[model samples]
Target chain A: MKKYKGYLIDLDGTMYKGTEKIEAASDFVKALAEKQIPYLFVTNNSSRTPEQVAEKLTEFDIPTTKDHIFTTSQATANFISGKKSNASVYVIGEEGIRDSIVEKGLQINDMNPEFVVIGIDREITYEKLSIACLAVRQGATFISTNGDIAIPTERGLLPGNGALTSVITVSTGVQPIFIGKPESIIMEQALKVVGTSLEDTLMVGDNYDTDIMAGMNTGLDTLLVHTGVTTVEMLQSIERKPTYTVGSLEEWIEKM
Target chain B: MKKYKGYLIDLDGTMYKGTEKIEAASDFVKALAEKQIPYLFVTNNSSRTPEQVAEKLTEFDIPTTKDHIFTTSQATANFISGKKSNASVYVIGEEGIRDSIVEKGLQINDMNPEFVVIGIDREITYEKLSIACLAVRQGATFISTNGDIAIPTERGLLPGNGALTSVITVSTGVQPIFIGKPESIIMEQALKVVGTSLEDTLMVGDNYDTDIMAGMNTGLDTLLVHTGVTTVEMLQSIERKPTYTVGSLEEWIEKM
Candidate 1:
């Protein structure tokens, strides 16, 4: 078996499931730390800051710092910064996206902005959507953190950012550039932050559509764990299989 | 030219355009009244009640009463009442839709509603959308008043009911039954209200997509005026043209 020099990990299903911690997650991180191998928790969650995500991981006994977390919000900020420095933006999201934009020195402007960014906004209002539609119609570049259609919760599957973004797209006839999982943009950014070559890095997750697809799009090997969304039976139905499949992280500890 | 027994007239582009009355519109309606020709103002606006719309028409010196106005709200109510008399519904809209549902003896219920109806609501909230999504996912029949993507105002085009409806559709992956112009449902109901036969009734409007398409779908003759959305150049591009294209309603008054 080939050994990877670095790893890109998923959060919700791979590291933990909601508030519950995965028993083998801490041990997997400890294995990487002992070998001095680089790894970053790549997440599509643009709602919380890296510090918040790191704190949650610490509670789960996972050895991760703020530097080990790379959220879609930071990727979006970096994506925009690469295009143009100090660009004006009209944002419809929570603290994490706002912090990332501010941290990258992007100006948050509602009227006549160069870009219109949408993330997960639980407090979304018609007025906010109206402004976004108007801005996009006025030729602002539309961008969304992720294209997640529905979010799972105790209540059930609620509307996600992609569903909310459809209002503007359907109204103004403009599709947004999604910057999160399954898209090569987020995976490429994660690779740069992890400081690893694509050939020597492995993208690991329990999901097939987002995580494995992200790895495939970024020219990296992918390891699909069965501890989360995609089961072995489900993977068999898919035409393109991931590079590796395992029941849990414990099965891959020997290779690490 | 064939003389029509009744007319289904569009409001925004035909009778008036955003608070300003067309010069030929009042004269055309007066000609209809003098000849005792039956005509109903057919509008896709689900936000305003018939009484309110009638009042506005009266202000513009157009001969109209609440009985002469046929809005999409009333058509939706009629459609639901025909399906199941006094059926329970979960609605998202202003007073217009609520009043119509109640007038038709339909019950307004959020918990386990038989139908999930969407109309234009300026006070739309995430909670309201969440409930609608949940109800739709729970096997409730979803319905939308119109599929008009944008509403033209003095401030420019704003997000319409169709845009707001996309949120629930995208989240739940359920296509809603649209009951407005271009859908034929409202046109069928308007024919009943106008007491006109399909062969004798003429659908008149300025928009080619909505008014003309509705007429074509319902197997009625259509008259396209040049005062609103469709232009002579635009009409030339369409493969299926209106039965009669005129520069103004005054040209059609002689035939009436």
Candidate 2:
């Protein structure tokens, strides 16, 4: 087995499932830490900040800090800042995305903006959607944190950011630049943050479509763990397989 | 021009534009009343009740009664009633759609509904959308009032019913049955209300896309009036033209 210098991990499914902690997750991180391998929790969750995510991971006995978290919100803000510093933006999201944009010194403007950014907003309203549509029609560059169609909860699968984003896309006839998983944008940003060469870094997650595809799209080797969404039976139908597949993160600890 | 036995007229673009009334609309409807011709106002607005719409038309000096108004809300309710009498429905709209559903003796159920219907809702919330999405995913038949992408307002073109509907459609990967203009559903309902045979009825309106296309789709002769949305220059680009083209409703008043 090839030794990886750094790791890009996925949350929700990989690190934990909803509010429940994955049994093998803590030990796997400990193994990586003992070897002094740097790893970042690359997540598509744009609702909560890194501090919040780190706190949750800490409760699960997983060694984590705010610096170890790299959410899609941060990637979206970074992408915008790379294009133009201090650009005016119309945002439709919660605290995480808003804070990230503000952290980058981007101006939040409702009337007229250079860009329109949308993230998962559980408090979403028709007025917010109307403002987004009007701005997009006025030639604002549209951007979404992620393209997650449905979010799993105790209640069942609910409409995700992708579903909400479709309102503006369908209305204004404008396609938004998605900055999260399965796209190279967030992966590239994560790679830069993790501070490792693509060849020496491994993308580890349980989702084939988002995490694995994101790694493949970014020219990084991927390890698919079966502890979450994608199962062994489900992966058999896929043509291109992940570089490594394991029943749990515990199985990969020996190799690491 | 061929004489028509009945007339199906559009409301917003044909009769009035926002708070302003069209100059030729009153004289045209008055001519229909004078000739004792049966004319029904067909509107895609699922927000306002037929009585409210009729009151507005009467205020504009157009001879209108609640009986002469046929809105998409009524059409949608009629459609649902035709499928299953007293069927439970999950509706996301204003008073118009809700009133029409109750008038049809249909039960409104948020949990485990037989049908999930969506109309234009200015007071739309994420919770309402989440309920609709959950219902649709749980095998409820999905229906939308209209597929008009944007609504013209004092502010600008705002997100329409179609845009709001996309959230569920995109999330659930299920296409909804649209019940408004450009679809034969609303036109068929309007024909029954107006007591008009498809061959002898004339569909009249200012918007070529909705009114004329609805007529064409329903096999009715269409008269496109250049008072609102569709202009003379715009009509030149369309390959399939309306049966009759007039500069204003006044031009057709003499023919009626």
Candidate 3:
């Protein structure tokens, strides 16, 4: 087995399942911590800030800090800042995405913006979608944090940012640049934040579509754990196989 | 020119354009009345009730009554009732859709609904979308009032019901049964209301994509007026042409 110098991990499925703790997750992270291997939690969730995500991981007894988190919100802000410094933007999202854009010095303008960014917004209104459509129609660059269609919640699968983003896309006839998993944009940014070369980094997650495809998109090795979402049966149906597959993260600790 | 016994006219672009009256609309409708031809105003707009739409057309000096107005909302309610009388429906729309459903004696149910209907809603919220998604995922039949992507307003083209419907469609991975123009559903229902045979009725409108296409879809002869969306230059590009093309309704008054 090839030894990875650093690791990029997923949040909801890999580290924990919703609010419940995964038994192998704590041990797996502790192994990485003891070995002094840098690992960052790369999450597509743009609703919550790094601090909030770190706190949740900490509650689960996983060694985490604000620096250890890399959200799609941060990736989106980084992407926009790279394009134009202090660009005017029309945003439709929660505090996480809003704060990230503002922290990067992007101006939030409802009218005549240079860019339109959409993230997961539970407090979303028709007015927000209307503004986004109008802005996109006016030739604003459209961007979305991620393209996850349904978000798994205790209540059931709810509409994700990708679903909400479709309103503006359909209305204005403009496709948005998605900056999350399965896209190289978020993966490349996560690699830089994790301070790891693409070849030396291992992307670990339970989702075959998002996490594994994201690693493949960014030219990194992927480890699929069967703790959530994709099972062994699901993997057999897929043509492209992950670099490694395990029943739990604990199975990979010795190799790491 | 073939003499049509009845007419199904469009409202927005044919009758009036956003509170502004079309000059040729009044004389044309008066001619229809004078000739004693049975006519009904067919509209894709599901946000307003028949009475409200009739009131607006009356204000525009067109001979219109609630009985002479057929809206997509009414078509949707009728569609649902035809499937199952008093069927439980989960709706995400404005007063027009809600009232139409209730008037048809359909029960409004958020939890465990038999059908999920979407229409244009200025007051749409995330919770409404969430409920619709959940209901659709739970096997409720999804229905959209119209597939119009954008609504032209004084400000600009805003997100229409189709755009809003995409949120639920994309999230739930379920396609909705669209009940408006370009689909034969609304036209078939409007034909029943207008008391006209398909061969004897002329579908008249300014928009080729909606009104003319609706006519074509339902096997009705179409007259495309160059007053709104589809222009002379735009019509030249289309392979399929309307049965008749006129500069204004005034030109057709003589034919009536």
Candidate topping DockQ: 3
DockQ (CA atoms), all models: 0.79, 0.86, 0.91
Clashes of each: 0, 0, 0
Give the range of the ten consecutive residues with the poorest summed lDDT in model 2 chain A.
A12-21
Q: How much DockQ does model 1 earn?
A: 0.79
**For residues B1-256, what per-residue lDDT tens digits would candidate 3 score against the true structure?**
7899999999888888887989999999999998999999988888888899888989988888899999999999999999999999999888889999999999999989999999998989999999999999999999999999999999899998999999999999999999999899999999999997999999999998999999999999999999899999999999999999999999988787
Candidate 2 local Cα displacement, residue A40, angstroms: 0.6
Score candidate 2 by DockQ: 0.86
Q: Give the 10-residue window scoring lowest on summed lDDT in candidate 2 chain B.
A: B247-256
Residue-level lDDT of model 3, residues A153-253, one tens digit each, is: 99999999889999998888899999999898999998998897888999999999999999999889999999999999999999999999999898899
Q: What does the TM-score come to for chain B in model 1?
A: 0.99
What tens-digit string does per-residue lDDT give for candidate 1 at A1-256?
9999999999988989888889889999999999999999999998999999999999999998999999999999999989899999999999999999999999999999999999999888878888888889999999999988888777777888889889999999999999999999999999999999999999999999999999999999999999899998999889999999999898899898
Task: Please compute and give the TM-score of the first chain of candidate 2 against the native first chain.
Answer: 0.99
Model 1 residue B176 CA deviation in Å: 0.8
Residues B136-248, model 2: lDDT tens digits:
99999999999999999999999999999999999999999999998999999899989979999999988998999999999999999888899999999999999999988
| Clash-forming residue pairs, model 2 | none
**Chain A: TM-score in each candidate?**
0.99, 0.99, 0.99
Better of 2 and 3 by TM-score: 3
Index of the highest-TM-score prediction: 3
Worst 10 residues of 1 chain B by lDDT: B149-158
Task: Give lDDT for model 2.
Answer: 0.94
